[model samples]
Target chain A: MRVLIQLRPAPDVVAAVIEPGVRATAADVAGRLPGVVLDQAFAPVAVPRPVPASAYGDPLSLNQRVEFSYAPQDAAVLVRGEIADDELSTRSVLLPSARRDVAGVFADPVIHSTPTCGGDGPVGHWQDVARLLGAPEMTVEGHDGSGVTLAIVDSGINAAHVQAHLGREVIIDTERSWSPPGVGGTPGEYPVAHGTMCAFDALIAAPRATLLDIPVLLSPHNVAGLLSDAVAAYAHLRTVLEAMPAGSRSLVISNSWGLFSPGQDFPPGHPGNYSDNLAHPFNLIVASLDQAGADIVFSAGNCGRECPDRRCGFPDRPITGANSHPRVLSVGGVDTGLERVGYSSQGPGRLSDRKPDICAYTHFAGSEANGPGTPDTGTSAACPVAAGAVAAIRTRHPATEISPAQLRTLLHRTAEDRSTLGFDHDYGYGVINPPAVLESLGRHTRHAA
Target chain B: MVLLTVRLPPGATLADALARLELAEEDVDTAFGLVPIDPGTGLYAVRVAEEASHRAANTAGGPFSDPPIAPHGSQDPHDRHAPPSG
Candidate 1:
C-alpha cells in the first residue's frame, strides 16, 4: 500500500524542506521507517499546519476558518513510501506511535480514468490481440503450441462455429474428450455459446494445439452444471494427463465458470462448505491436478465491484473455491487496449487472497459466438486467451523441463506491471506479456544449453 | 446428490466402493460412478444421496456441497446481464 507519511522531523529539517531550492529528499524528513520502503525519488514537501483563525474556534475541528502556518516548529514534512500489502493494517496503526515525529499516515491510492466495463464496446479485434501477443514472432521461434493439449472445461464447444470464426482447422481430440452423464451432444458439437467463444479465443495463440472438449457444464435441465460434475470432469482429465509419458506431459485446462451465489453453497465455516474450505473435494482435486503437472487457468469471475454480473452473490471477495486456488492461474479481464474491464473480480480472494493472478485480453471482436458483432467479453474470454498463451509456451517448455509452478512464476515475473506497486488486486501481476515470457524463456534455454 | 470421498486403492471400481461402504446399489448415483480425486493419495469420490453420505460418514470424507456453476460471460455485451446459455 502506497502511503504519505507526515513527520514532525527536526525544526531545521522542516525549514530545509520549506526553503526554496533546498530540494530535501524523503530520506531527510522521514528516515528509515521500520515497515515502509521510502520512495527515494520523491522530494520531501512541507505541509502547513492548520490553526483556528479565532481563539474561540475549536483547535481540533476544521469546520471553522483556519490559518495556514509554515512555521518550522508547527509545520509537518510529508514523505512518500509504501507498506507491504499484507502488513498494511498492522503497520498503519503502529507507525504513529513507533515514531513520535510521525504525525499521521495516509493512503496513496492509484487514480485512474474511468475503467472499461461490461457495457463497453470492443476495444480492438482479435488480430490486434495476436499482434500484442506477438503471435507471428512466437510461431517463428517454434512456440506455436504444436503438441500441447488445451482443454476447455465449460459448455460443450461447437467445433464448426469456432473453425468458421478462427478461419483455421480446429483440432478436437475426440478420443480424449468426455461429457458429463446425460449430456447428449458429442464433444465439440454442443452449441455456439460460451464454450465456442473460449475455444476460438484459445486458438488465437495456440492454433495447432490439440483441444480436449470436456463439456462439463451441459446439464440436462440447464446449461449450468453442479460443482460435483466438474469434480468428475477433472477426474477424467487426470487420467488423460497420466496417460502421457511423464517426461513430455503438457495439459492445460481452461475454466471460465464459477459458482455464482453463496446461497447455493454451504456457509463459509461449515465443514461441507466449498467456497472457503480447502478440504472440500473439488479444491483437493484441483490441487491433485496441479501436483500431477497440469496448468489450470480459471476466470476470476464477473463480480468486479464497478459493474458485476447480476448473478454475483458473494458480498465481497467473490473469487472463490478452485478459481482462487493458489495452484491455478486466476485470470481477470482487460480490453485489447490493456484497460481492466469493470467486471473482472478483484482479489483478496476467498480461498487465497491476492488473486486474479493476472489480466488478459477480452471485450474484443472475435468469436461471434455471442452474436453477429458482439465482443467476446468478460474474464471468461480472458481465461482461455491466457490458457492459449500457456499452450504456446508449453509447445517447447514441457512440464518435465519447466514445471507449471515455475512457469507461473516466470509469467508473473515477466508481466507488464499495471500498478505502481506490484501485484495489486485489480490487475494482479499486470497484463500477460507473451513476448516478454518468450524472451525470458529464450534466455533461460540458452543459459541451460 | 452430494459428493463424498473415500480411500480406495488405485483401479478400484464403483462396486468395490459400494461394498466397502456397505451401501446398497441404489444408494449411490451409479451413472456418476467412483471417480478418483487423487490417485496418488488413493482418494476417490462418488456422488451419493445425502442419507447415504451420512451412513458412510465414519468411512467417507464428506457430504460436500455441489453448488451450480455458470459461465462468467453474458451472451450479449449490450445486455451485460444476459445469461450465457441464452
Candidate 2:
C-alpha cells in the first residue's frame, strides 16, 4: 500500500527541514504514526521542476513537497490522520485497489506464414491503407516524416528487428529511454513483441521519422505494474522531450496501452482512474506535456464488442481513464472495409465531448515479424498509423508548429465521416483521410506564408 | 538472394518445416528472417541464400512449389484482446 503525503510548509520551513534531508524530514513527520515508513520524497528543483502540479500542488510556485511512502494496509486510518495534519493541505492514498492484468493491453499481431492471395495485387495491406489515406501523395510531396520524432511509450521495442524490416536505421535515440528501477535490461535489448509491432505500424506511415523507444512496460509484471510506475515513467518522458535540442520539428508520442475498468468508482481518487480532474497527478502531467508541444496519442482499448476479453470489459460507460482525456488524440480502429473493428473501444469520453478523436485502419501489415507482411491488427495498430500520418505532415511543414488542440481540430475537421452522418461513439470524427489532411495543411501553410 | 514460397502440406506446421529444413533455431529470426505470407495458412515466403533454395524445396517435400506473391487479403480471425496463443 502506497500513500502520497502532500506537505505544505513555508519557504523557511522547507529550507530548514529539507536542509536536514527529505528522509529525516519525513521521519520527523512519520513519528506521529508508529507503523508508517518513509519511502521517497520529491523536492522541487531549483530550475523549473519537471514534476507535475498535481504531484506536489502548484508546481510553478514550489510551495509544497510530496512524499510517497508505504504502511500496512490495516493501518490506513492511523496513517491518514498523521499525514493530514494542519500543515498538510491534502493527502492521497496511492494504494492499488485491484490488479490490472496486462493480458490484453498489448495487442499481438497475427502472423501469417504465407500471404493470402487476391485483392489489390501484391501490395501489402498497409500500403493499400496508406494509398487510401493519401500517404502516397504525401510521400510524393516529400513528407515521409524526415524531420519528426515519434516516441513509442509501451513495452520496449526490438530495435534490430525493426531496423532490419524497415531496412533503415530510424531509431535515432534510446539514450533517454527507461524502464522502472528494478526492471533491468537496456530499452532496445528487451524483445517486447508489442512494442516492436507498434513501432512497425507507426513506421508504415512515417518511414523516415526517428523513433524514441521508451519502454514503460516490462516483463514479469501486469497492468498494475505499469499503473504504479506510469507517473515516474511519464516524468522521465518529459525529461527526454525537454532534453531534445531546440528545433522547429514536431514531436509525437504513441501510447498503445491504457487501463480500462480501474476496478473502482470515479471522484474517489482511484489510482487507475486518470480522471479529468486537473488536480489528478496523471492528468496534470499529461497536460504539462501537451503544453510543452508533444502531441500524445493513445489507443482506445479493444472493448468494442460484448467485451469477451478481460482488457475489454463491456462497462455501462463509454470510455475510461487517460484514453478518455480531452488533450490526447484517442484513436479507434477500423477494418479495411472501413467498418469499426468489433473490438475498438467506443466513446463519449469522460472528459472530451466525443472520443476517439479519429479512426484508422487495423489489420495492418508492418514490421512485427522478420518481414513487412505480418498482420498487426487492433486499435493498437490504429493509434500509431494515425500518429505516423501526423508525423508525415510535421515532417513536411516543420515550421507550421500546430498546437495539440489545433491539430485535433484539423484532424476532426478533415476526417472522412463514417457510421452515422456526423460524430458518433464508434467512429469518432471518422477515418483519417491523409490526403485531405495534407491538403488542409498545405492551405494553412500557404495562408501563413 | 532467392525468395522461396514454401507451402506446408495439409496438417503440417511451421515447426515441422523448420525441422525438416534443418535450420537451427538461431538461424530463423522471426523478426526478419522468416516472412509470413499468410499466417492463417502455414505458407511462408522465405528469402534464403541461393545455395539453400534446393535444400528448402527438398525439405518442403510435395508441397514445395513457387507461388506468386499474393496481396494479403485474408482477415486475421485472432482477437487482439486475447492473450497470445502459441
Candidate 3:
C-alpha cells in the first residue's frame, strides 16, 4: 500500500507542503478516517544525495526518492493506508488535500533485476563474433577503436582480468568512471564476472577503446537491489556525462541487462513496467543520453523458450523498459550457426514496432579472470560485441558528428538481413555486419569530403 | 510456506532441480522463481506453497527444510543480459 502523494501548493502554501508540517496534517487526517493508518511522509529535496557506492551505507536506498515532480508542486509524501477496494475509491473524497495541498496520488511500484555464466566446457571465441560480423577485415584496416570510449554499465567490471585476457594495456578510467559514491571496491575488483566478461567481449571488437566501468548494481545480497539501483545510477550517469567536455568523442554505452518478468499486478506507468512512456525515469535518462550523442545498446533478455531454459516459463511479452526505448539499440542473440538462440528474447518491444534492432553471436567465448572458465555468453555477450563494433566505427570517424539516430540508421541500412525479410522480430534488420557498416561509413565520409 | 535446500548432482542444471521441486504455474507466486545458492555447486533455496513441502523434502539429499538458509553469497549480485549459462 505504498502511495506517492504529489503536492500542488501555491507560493504561500508551499512552505506547509514542503515542510514536515504537511506530513503531520496528513497523519492527523488519516487518524480520523476509518481503516487508514498514516505510515510515512517524504519531503521533497531540490537535489537528491548522490547514491552511495555501497548499498547498505545509503539511508535513502530503502525509501522512494522523488525523481521528478511538476513545477509549483512541493514534495511527494508516502503513506500506507489499509482500506478495502470499494472503500479505497472514497480516498479522493476522504483524504486531506486542498488544505494540506496534495495534488495527485499514485502507487510506488517495486522493480526487479532481469536475471548469466559460461566458461571452459563449451567456450565461445571472440573470433566467432568477429567473423560473424566480418570485423577482421575492418580491424586490419585500422578501425580498432583507438580514441573512442565504451562505457560498460553493469554489476561491476573486473578491469584486471580484462587486461590479463587481452595481453596488453587497457585503459579503465576509474576517476572518470562512476560507481555509487562510497563503495570500497574498484571496478572489476569485486567478484562479479558479468561486467568483466562484457568488457572482454567489447574489447574483442574494439581493442583500443578506453573502458568506463560504471557499476550501478550494488546489492550483492538481493535481486531487487539490482533492479532498483539502476534508475539512480542512470541519473548519476546523466550528471557525469553532462559535465564532460562537449567536443570529446561521444561514448558508446553497453548495457546487457533488463527486467524480464514484470509480475501480473504491475501498473502501466510503473518504472518496472518498462513502458515507452517518456515520463519513466529510466527512459528520461536514456533520452538524455541519446540527446548527448551517446550510442546506448541493451540486450533484449533471454526468455524466448519454454520451461527448460527460462524460469519464467514462456514470455507473454518479451521486451520492455529501457530495452524497448526507440533511441537505444536493442540486440538479440544468435549462435554460431547464424540462427536465433532458443533463449534470445523476441519482440515487438513495448514502445517500438520493430525490436531487437539487430542480432550478434552468443556462446561467444572470451577470457575471465575471476571464475574458472570463460563465463561470457548470451545477448549479454552480443551487446558488447555490437558496442565494440560501433566504437570502432566512431574511432574511424572521430570528427564526424554521428548522432545516435544516425548510427542506428547506418546499422539498419548495412545489416545483413537474415530472417523473414527487411526487418524481423528475431533478427531485427539482420545480423550486425561490421565490415558493411564501416564501408557505409566510409562512403559517407567520402561523400561528405 | 516451505523452505528447502536441494543439492543437485554434477551436470544437473538449475532447471532440473526446479522441476524436481514440482512448482506448478498456479503455485508460482513470487516476483522471481528461483534463487541460486551457487549454480556451480548445484545448491538452491526453494520456497514453495506448504502443500508441496513434503515433495520437496523427498528429493535425494533429503530436504534441509527446517529453516531455509539464504542463497550463496557471490561477488556479483546483479543479473546479466544472457541466461546464466551459455
DockQ for each of the predicted structures, in order? 0.48, 0.03, 0.04
Model 3 chain A, TM-score vs. native: 0.68
Provide the lowest-lDDT 10-residue window in model 1 chain A. A113-122
Candidate 2 stretches with Cα past 4 Å from truth are A1-124, A219-224, A245-249, A264-278, A306-308, A369-374, A398-400, B1-86
* lDDT per residue as tens, model 3, B7-81: 676556446656776656445324333433333455544445556655555572322211111101123313432
TM-score, candidate number 3:
0.59
Model 2 scores what on Cα lDDT?
Answer: 0.58
Query: TM-scores of the first chain across all predictions?
Result: 0.78, 0.67, 0.68
Candidates 1 and 2 compared by DockQ, better number: 1
Task: For model 1 chain B, give the 10-residue run with minimal summed lDDT.
Answer: B77-86
Per-residue CA lDDT of candidate 2, range A1-449, in tens? 34343333234433444343542344343333233344435332111123433654764454556433222211111112223243232222222112121001111233323211111111247667777767767777888888688888767688788787767675656676666656677766666367777787788778888887766666234432333345446656766656655567478888777654433223324321244343344555577777677788887766665322344333544455567788889898776777676657778776665897899877556554423344666577788888888888778555236776788888889998985478888889998887787788789779999
Candidate 2 vs candidate 3: the lDDT winner is: 3
Chain A agreement with the truth for model 1, given as TM-score: 0.78
Per-chain TM-score of chain B, candidate 3?
Answer: 0.47
Put down candidate 1 lDDT per residue, B2-82, tens digits, no spaces.
Answer: 888899987899999998888888999888899898888899988889888889988888889988988897655455444
